[model samples]
Target: MLTQHTSTCGKSTGTSTGARPGRPSCSLTQRHLQRGWFSRTPLHCPHRILSSSQAGCRLCSGKKRQYSASVRASSAAGAADLPAPRENLGDRIGAFRNAFWKFLRPHTIRGTILGSCAVTARVLLECSEYIDWGLAPRAALGVLALLCGNGYIVGINQIYDVDIDTINKPFLPVAAGELRPALAWVLVVGLAAGGLALTAANFGRTITLLYSLGLFLGTVYSVPPFRLKRFAVAAFLIIATVRGFLLNFGVFTAVRAALGAPFVWSPAIIFITCFVTVFATVIAITKDLPDMEGDLKYKIDTFATRLGTKNLARLGTALLVANYVGAVVTALRMPHAFRVPLMVGAHAVLALNIILETRRLESQQHSQLAIRQYYQAIWRLFYIEYCLLPFL
Candidate 1:
């Protein structure tokens, strides 16, 4: 008889049958394509719910079927051991996802479209209130440049730091051998091409400038003696300043051009851009903190390495507070509008996080978590604020 296996997915009795009638087999062997999620070092299932099927795992609840690998092995050992009918399809789908994910993995690509694009959702939404600010299509293209370019730059940088990341980020795609350099390069090229193509597709002339800038920064950030990372101060300026400006430039140009109108920067527009820049700078600094050790060892003179963690944290906190105060000041000075109060409330949360976390991390050991929180706080704050844009 073929045995049935039971697993948990919020308790409905998880059963997968691979055996014939009568008798019991403990095993239900199936091909699993999710090596990273399901079969990592110790292997961890991310969601308690039925998340992605890529990392399929066996269940052992023991009701109609008991967990018995031995019995199933004996029964099905001589069996074909071939890929299940659906497994092949799942693998292909997963490969497709992985390719896209690797190309634009700004937010890790498990959910949402991508990080760069998502970040601008709120900004674009707000800008839309004031101006025609393009729509999702062109905004998406700019985000593509940011996401894919970052991927290219990071991937190429990883090729250089394989040994460094091997020890520091053991599970990093490159470190763990999940992504190879050759394959990564192909993705990088494709994504960059896609970004440029999307620009040419609609936003033509304006896109030419922005795309070139994004791509140039991507190439120079990690390559050559100009390996901009070696110069921490300059690196900080490049990423933070450039990214913040590009976000505004992209939406402003696309929206204005589409509407066939000249762009006007109102107090409201300047406020949002400044807000984005300050917060982006703060988060960028926080990211720099975690790489302190690697930066110091590798001669990377980041803010944390040069200014020291204590000072860097203070700087980050200062920037966060400045962002909050700026928001408040702008809201008060601006004409009466619901967007002002909402933006203030959203940024208030981010400010609180900065005030709390920055004071606590006295040293670099806490960098990993601190850095992650930086991103989470940024996004949560963004979503809250951005959601208000459409209402206004």
Candidate 2:
């Protein structure tokens, strides 16, 4: 007879005749064997053969190892499915700032700034013997109001011409998808409202009325039902009126009001108004030169399309030359006290520059790049004219 031993697992370690004595066995061991959980060398419970505590520790350690591996695999899969981190606030803000700057059309903004400052300075010089430093704040406020109006005009034009811009100015914010149309519309409306409020609150009636008229012209120039930009003559007149006549006259009136001086149409104002009106017409014409493809595709009639690029370029150059000549003759006629030499020299030099630029464009066969460069040069001359306005 063989002695039988009972393990903590509650199975007898007894065998029948011809079986190995003390070989551990249990129902749990049999299940492990069927599932191939144990080694193939023997039919025995490895856990049962050990002391109870030691067997429990080994089994627990095995389960812990298996659980840890499963957990690690699950974690890796989840991590792989996770979304990428978001852009930080600073980066998002910087992108929007850049886009907004582009949306404002920096060149046009610079022109507005220079024109406002020049008009304000000229008015101050005319009204007072010494510069009134106190009026600087008011002048700046007027500039801001004008800038808001300018932004509204350009912003609305961009909104309406998004499709046209995709072909002509693909880098524009709205056309490039850098700005949403709804957001752009909101900005434009806010700008218009802000400009009106600023003008109405801070300026006299003449300034307010002129500002209102400018805003109206700007609205009709680009907005539907009166998109005068589609008509060559109307577009030219509108641009010349708002950017050339209205801008200078309004700023001059505002500054004169600030100085408590009665508004007078000085020779300086008249000269600048006429000069810039012609210049603005040139701008309106050349602005469409590089955009001819888009303008034609969309049936937006412009001077550049009516007169071919080369012909229009000649026309702009001829007009600019005539303008400079007129300035030179006018400067000569002015009394010696009016800085005649500076005016004559500046106009003469500008006339020469325009002639040279035109020749270069012609030599380049009026290619798109040449046309764009010419347009940019025209704007540069425009800036220089504003700088000279105060002296006049």
Q: What's the CA RMSD for each of the models? A: 14.2, 12.7
- lDDT value, residue 129 of candidate 2: 61
Candidate 2 per-residue lDDT, tens place, 259-376, comes to 7787678888888989999999999888999999999999999999899999999999999999999988888887553578888899999999999999999999999999999999
Model 2 segments more than 4 A misplaced: 1-84
lDDT of 1 by residue, 294-320 (tens): 666777667777787667767877877
TM-score of each: 0.65, 0.78
In order of listing, the candidates' clash counts read 4, 0
Which sections of candidate 1 miss by over 4 Å? 1-103, 108-147, 336-340, 359-371, 382-392
TM-score of 2: 0.78
